[model samples]
Target: EAGVTQFPSHSVIEKGQTVTLRCDPISGHDNLYWYRRVMGKEIKFLLHFVKESKQDESGMPNNRFLAERTGGTYSTLKVQPAELEDSGVYFCASNYGQGRAFFGQGTRLTVV
Candidate 1:
């Protein structure tokens, strides 16, 4: 019955640092996704996961990032050697069987 939860609501890291963000969706949801909004731009889809498998990842920016859903429970997005351009608000959402997505407060990443 709880909504999605994302850790570290805000992050500040130096360029080239590695950061991992975690997302825990509602208990019974099977659809999970990561989205981003950069500097006032429109929210962009980053990836989607159906259970433990990545369903769609075309929106992922580059190889510097990695996403995983372990045991089909929680998900994590990791950025290695992060770039300044990666600074943005990262959102996590989930739903049950095609239902409307419930989003977290989002983790604001600042790479300086």
Candidate 2:
């Protein structure tokens, strides 16, 4: 089974542009998570989805970012009016129940 897949491995956009990042987790995995490392800071957890519902989203920066997992199949993270401070590598991970998470190659976003 494929672990996890992320689209548009890299994105370069002007400030204020909108960018969407997608993540497809391993089949049958009910625990999905989103994480990121910004400006050499610790890789922080953005959110976690148990199936289609968001279980934890304490690390989300603000309202400009949104994340969704439709029907518990896949997830998408959208950033509206992207800012220079948002440039970083966004990572997605998944697990079956309580085991370790399997991470996808991150999507690098550069806001100019």
What is the per-residue lDDT of model 1 for residues 45-72, given as tens digits with 9 covering 90 to 100? 9999999999999999999999999999
> What lDDT would candidate 1 get against the real structure?
0.97
Question: 31, model 1: CA deviation in Å?
Answer: 0.4
Cα-based lDDT at residue 7, candidate 1: 96
Mark the regions of model 1 whose C-alpha exceeds 4 Å error after superposition: none
Error of model 2, residue 98, in angstroms: 0.3
Candidate 2 runs further than 4 Å off: none
Clashing pairs in 1: none
Q: Which candidate is the best by lDDT?
A: 1
lDDT of 2 by residue, 1-112 (tens): 7779998799999999999999999999999999989977999999999999999999899999999999999999999979999999999999989988999999999999
Number of residue pairs clashing in candidate 2, backbone atoms closer than 3 angstroms, sequence gap of 3 or more or interchain: 0
Q: For each candidate, what TM-score against the reference?
A: 0.98, 0.97
Worst 10-residue lDDT window for candidate 2 reads: 1-10
Q: What's the true lDDT of residue 15 in model 1?
A: 99
